[model samples]
Target: MTKSNFQILLADDDEDDCMFFKDALDELSLSATLKTVRNGVELMDFLENNLSNLPQVLFLDLNMPRKSGTECLLEIKESEKLRRLPVIIYSTSSNLEVMDMLYCKGAQYYIRKPADFADLKFVINRTISLLKEKNVQHPTREEFVIQT
Candidate 1:
């Protein structure tokens, strides 16, 4: 897909944070379809239904109302159909234990959520640019977006 024709799915429990992300995405003109899942369970349900046309990337949060980011990442990694898409854990805290667990569980990347709006915009822009500039070394095979 082209730069202006990309999709990004973000999973977070907080409404305010999601709204901020939506604004940041719009400001960047990333042209992504931002799907918001309330918790890990809903995320799986969405993925189960949308795996055929999975989003190009996913940004997830650590703490949620129901299932956690760790659970969601594990489920996605184990899935045959939805394992290729990239998953980034966007959380507020930088706990070493959580970070290590997520990395071991197959998360593509771990990003500390930005407190400032401008910083959030910068992070999102960098993320989009990274996706846009990624080199597909093995183009034929479908590959997961490894964010770490």
Candidate 2:
């Protein structure tokens, strides 16, 4: 899809965070459409059902209930149909080990959820730009985690 009409899917449990994310996207004035799921189970179901019409990017939260983002990421990578879809780990966790594991598991990038709305917008915009420029190619370890 074109940059003006980017499709984004977000798997996050917190209502406040979701609101903030949507608000940030709105404030940024990018013509991006966002779809959100409450947990990993829903996220997987959505992806499975929309195999032919997948989003340009998935912003996945790590600490969801029922099914964790790690499980979802593994399943996505294992699936032939979903393997190429870009997944950005949007989480609060800054644990290096977890980030490393996620990067190894095929996540396109890791973003520690920014506290400020401006930073959030910046990271999201930067991520979209990177995905557009890189075409989902795995970056080096040094560039795996995006710090805002």
Candidate 3:
């Protein structure tokens, strides 16, 4: 298959946050598509069913109904088919212990959801830049958590 644009998946239950993310991507003027799942179950279902169309990266919210982001991350890393996919923890929580566990479990990055639209745009832009550069597949411990 010929893929011309970047594919991004976001698993966030918050409707407002989801809208903000899509809006941010629209404002970036980048060649990328954003697909969203409201919860962890849907996120895993999409990933598991769409083996041929797996997204280049996944932005997961740590808090959600049903399975949480941490649970999804663990499952993703455990599955051979999904282990290589980059999972970014995008959440409002900044618990150091939780962040450290996620990093150790193979999440590519952890982004604390920014309150401002501008900050959200900046974070998304930075994420896309890293994806393009392909330098952060295995970032250092110091660079694991992205700060606004």
lDDT of each: 0.77, 0.94, 0.89
Model 1's TM-score against the true structure = 0.86
Kindly list the per-residue Cα lDDT of model 1 for residues 1-148, writing each as its tens digit. Answer: 7776588889999999999999988888566677788888898889998867888888999798678888888889898887777777899877778777677677666678887888888888876666667641222112322223
Per-candidate RMSD, Å: 4.7, 0.8, 1.7
Q: Write the per-residue lDDT of candidate 3 for residues 26-130, one digit (tens) a residue.
A: 899777888999998998999999999898899999998899999999999999999989999999998899988999999998899999999999999887777
Segments in model 2 whose C-alpha atoms lie over 4 Å from true places: none
TM-scores vs. true structure, each candidate: 0.86, 0.97, 0.95
Q: Model 2: per-residue lDDT, tens digit, 1-148?
A: 6967799999999999999999999888678999999999999999999999999999999999999999999999999999999999999999999999999999999999999999999999899889989888999999998877
Q: Residue 56's C-alpha lDDT in candidate 3?
A: 85
TM-score winner, 1 or 2: 2
Q: What's the distance in Å from true for residue 132, model 2?
A: 0.5
Comparing 2 and 3 by TM-score, which wins? 2
**Alpha-carbon runs more than 4 Å astray in model 1:** 135-148
Lowest lDDT block of 10, candidate 3: 1-10
Name the runs in model 3 displaced over 4 angstroms: 1-4
**How does residue 3 of candidate 3 score in lDDT?**
33
